[model samples]
Target: MDDGSAPAAGGYVLGSTDREMARLAALSEVYGPVTAAWLDSAGLRPGATVVDVGCGPGDVSLAAAERVGPTGTVLGLDAAPRPLELARARAAAAGLRNVSFEQADVTRWRPPAPVDAVVGRLILVHLPDPVAQVARLAGTVRPGGVVAFADVALSTRAAQPELPLLTAFNAWLLGTFTRSGRPVDMALRLTGVFRAAGLPDPVLTAAAPLERGGDAVGWSVVAGDVAGLLPVMERTGVATREEIGPETFEQRLRAQAAEHDAVLVNPLVVGAVARTPDGGG
Candidate 1:
């Protein structure tokens, strides 16, 4: 959920285009397992209500709805209306009546009532002040309710054979994000964010997908991200259109993986799960 709602705070660098939405769908596949685990650790159960902040296309929101069962409800919020529209359509397609979507700036939006949990993924990094935002979200949940989030740590990407193209891809991703003024290190800072939010110390877990040989989904995600950020790369001088060669980006990445019999490790996604104070501390 890029903040077209608040451009001065540096709107979501990755624009909410169809291509970016597709990238998010692919990313959901990669992230689904780890996210489910995070929710489990946070004790998100059936009959609980959750709010998915910055829910692009409603992936996480839909997942939470499934976990919370028919009696529970999920509200998916995003600053971009396009994703919210897509999210509604997806919920309908999935026959998930318990989940719904809305468009609003997370920093300013307030829930009508306290929920059982408030969650987000890949959202805090785009915020101007993640700690304050976490505190605000924490406030939206009932005392002892769950507050869980996940973010990428690009620096955790690695390859066993150290493929050059993979290296370049990592550099392009990190450079573009850094230049956009987003926190590239948000994953590592989750603990401090939770502590400062006045929540209990969160249980942190991090995982990276490893792909070896043949055509890999990891490469597709990388290519999709580069494709989505081409304009940003050019604007920020991270890399130029000619240099990236978006047309063959995936092919080049796969070719390198095959040639070196390399094992590619995608970025690490870190999850933090904590509960609001039972005493409302």
Candidate 2:
């Protein structure tokens, strides 16, 4: 992987759009608590500096700031400008002076000084070489500092009273990532990546969201995620406009869920935390 500086011209595979921003915001609401727990387990604490890589919309960064408090500092980094702008706005609105967002490519970014921890969520799967990327992240922190990440293993998704449309859309999304040279289940390989990066064996944990019928928030979260990808899925021919049109696809999913009393189980999110050695990289 590159050194975290050379950003892709178009940035993230899921292009930044209004729908994508909404999706990210919903995801933060849904997953933020668990992610905060994971980061805390990874050794983030009051007055400790941290960096949130691929910090889209700054949810994790905001959480980190809350954890680290006023004395501590958190920097949010992403290649996309739109999300960074939103992140900045949210931070300002939230009155979080300890956190800041910057537009930077994780693959080529290098922190000015070593920090206490480096963290990212849902970003490793989009990289070509997650192991190398992890290594680079490890290098950004001080010795004995932590490197933590969370990502989805897309292949592990399942639903009860299965919604065919939802399932097929997920499959198509995974295929789109694969065709674009990204790993769809990088979380499953995170331990190996940490080891290959020369970090000690990482502590790993996983969770999945199980949303039952009539949960609008849950369904909206799912819909936002799927809708954000519809354009790319159609453009790549992984799906067709008629098959996965943004307007009706989510409605169909909701109808299916309501009709079947369905239980929607999204992909397992695997989190890994490793400590850099006493001798820095």
Candidate 3:
């Protein structure tokens, strides 16, 4: 893997204490089961080995362990130790000896053996070289091993009308990430990454956005949130508000929260599965 210069190796923006990550988990809990199901359906056996990349808090790692049963093993790796510690604690609480979590930049890390499946959720987007990383991941799969991944588009558009301010804010937010070269569009371009890395074409699937109302409403509760992202967006000209009226965002959040049914929209998450050149099932 040539240890390509790592991008924010251990500085992943999504941290345990970050409010945005907290809200994201709340929403993604409902959305991620679909992705987990696909991973479970692919290359899983009583003794299969699965590698979960960017395995934050080991939710998917533990889940994969359960799916593969005690006979199988799940190794989840991440660049950050905070998430790994949480993942370890979770596994410990569940007595999931089959699952292990380690901390290392995946770009410089390699698996001890070719695994049955290599998976990552919302990982590649943060990478400086998404294509190269995908290729590197392909190298970890056993002959005919599977690679499954999922991510979302930067923009979460909806047919339903939205507050003009929120709509504009969302648009600016998308550009902010894109300018930094980590656009959410990676959700769909995974096929390109695979092809560019010379891996087999994948079977792709999608899960559409589901509304998340209640206390979770407002931009603060979405992807990056405006506060943590405002500085970056402003520097890049992705967003510029003339004035942020006091508690305006808070009021909007409260309003949306009250609706409880305010339909939140997001791009469909695209998931893919592919095999290595060899036909080892």
Summarize candidate 1's per-residue lDDT along 133-206 as a digit string, tens digits: 99999999998899999998878887779988878888998887777777777888899999998988899877
lDDT of 2 by residue, 225-249 (tens): 5666665666566888677666876
Candidate number that wins on lDDT, 1 or 2: 1
Which rank order by lDDT, best down to worst?
Answer: 1, 2, 3
11-77 in candidate 3: lDDT tens per residue? Answer: 3443444554465555456566667766755657778899999887777788789888999999999
Whole-model lDDT, model 2: 0.79
lDDT of each: 0.85, 0.79, 0.68
**Best-fitting candidate, measured by lDDT?**
1
Every model's TM-score: 0.94, 0.91, 0.83
